[model samples]
Target: MSLSSFGFLIEEASRNVRRNGLMSAASITTVAVAMAVLGSAVFLLHRVQQFMDAQPRQFEIAAFVTMETSRSKAAQLKAKVQRIPGVYRVSLVPREAALRQMMDEDHKAGTRITDALVGANPLPDRLDVQLSDPKATRRVAAILRDKDKFPAIEHVRDDRETLDKLLATTRLIRNVGMAVALLLFLATAFVIQNTIRLTIFARRREIRVMQLVGASSGFIRMPLVIEGVFCGLAGSIIACGLVLLVIRQVSQFAGRLQTPFAFTMPAAMSPSVIVGLLLAAGAAMGWVSSTLSIRRYLRRV
Candidate 1:
């Protein structure tokens, strides 16, 4: 279309919104509420996935050395474990150090259970192993357990069960969020579609007059479609603002937590990306809803 024609379409679309101010405001508000709910779910799922991905990097494997193993032999085993593929780092924790740590923890908790041991440090020397890929945790633990290859080690332990539970929980959260988000998306679209249809209905007489004056269906539909897009965009901006405010408040609350429950914001859930996603979703919903609504009405006319 030419500049003049495009300007006319924009003007007409603007006029339509102004003429139906109440309905337009209602449409914008409905869209904002729907988008906000859907956006929160999507954002939460993204953060959970990010947390799950980072978990493996923090997981550790522990290999306990037998009481008969000499300090020199334990050091050799640590060096050997470090040389293994996928092993990121290995540090030796002597039984004495372990005993001290355990006692310190017990004291902090107001429990003196270790006081009964009285110079009998039953804690064994262990190798704390970090892995480049946590998927190899079991394999590396098995290697450390092999008696013929590493006779100094008596027990192999890892956070495999904890990791499994964590992964399963995140997966469940992600799947449920996705399902809910999908439903909300459809609901949002439906609301926009119905709202746009109402706007078209209110302007049916004007549309008929335009057609009688030799206006093509496209000429009549373009302005309404643009109006729908405007409404969608307006709603999305509001939704994004609300979502950011909530996220900021949530982050503040999380920071105040004094336990392991405290967490950092996921890098993937950046504000820029969130804003862009909501804007795109809003614009697309408006365009699709208006196009479909106008097309169906034009056919019946």
Candidate 2:
């Protein structure tokens, strides 16, 4: 379209908004509210996924050796375990270290359990193994249990259950997030469509007059479509700002918690890219709603 045509479309869209000011405001407000909720959910899901990805690295495999294992044999076993596929690092914890750890735990628990009172330190030397993939921990544990490899092996411990729980929770959150987002999107579309319907109804005579004057449907519809797009763009901007404010407040609150919370801002995409996506979503909703409302009126006229 020429610049003049574009200018006329803009002028007509502006006139439509001014003529139905209250309905326009309502439409923008509804879009903003729904978009804000959906945006916040998306941001939260992204942050949670990031946090989960970062936490899996902290899971470790504890390979406990039999009490009768010699120090030299334990060292050899530790080296062998480190060579296993997916194993990242292995640190040997001597029996003395284990005793010290147990004593520390006892102190924390307010229980006075001393090595002398226990007659001997029953703690055995073990290897603390870090794995590249937390999912492969079960296999790694099985390998350590091989009698021929390390006969003195006693037990293996890893946060496999905890990791499983976390994964399941994340998946649940993702499913719920998608469902909520879809519902909010449909609600927003309905609200916008109804709002446009009202606006079109108020201008029923004007649309009929344009049709009578040999105005093509495209000429009549272009301006209204532009108006819907403007409403969507305005609403998206408001929604983005509101979402940022809510995220900031949530981050501050999370920071004040006694236990550390892995709260990070959603991944930073280019500002242009984010704005483009929001604008596109808003525009698409607006255009579809406007088209439906206009079609309904045209059929009657």
Candidate maximizing lDDT:
1
Tens digits of lDDT, candidate 1, 46-90: 778888877766678889999999899999889999999989999
TM-score of 1: 0.79
State the local distance difference test value for candidate 1.
0.85
lDDT of each: 0.85, 0.79
Off by over 4 Å in 1: 65-75, 82-126, 131-136, 146-148, 256-268
Q: Which candidate should be chosen as best, given TM-score against the real structure?
A: 1
Deviating ranges (above 4 Å) for candidate 2:
53-58, 64-79, 82-135, 145-148, 151-155, 253-276, 295-297
User: How accurate locally is residue 47 in candidate 1, as Cα lDDT from 0 to 100?
Assistant: 78
Pull out the clashing pairs in model 1. Answer: none
Query: On residues 1-301, what C-alpha lDDT tens digit does candidate 2 reach at each position?
Result: 7899889879988999988888889889989998888887776677667767765466678889888889999998888888999998899999898888778766866778674557577778989888888788889888887878767888887778877887789889988997998999989888877877776777778778888898778888887788787788788888888877777776777566543222344454444555566678888888897788677655435
- What's the TM for model 2? 0.73
* Residue 243 error, candidate 1, Å: 1.0
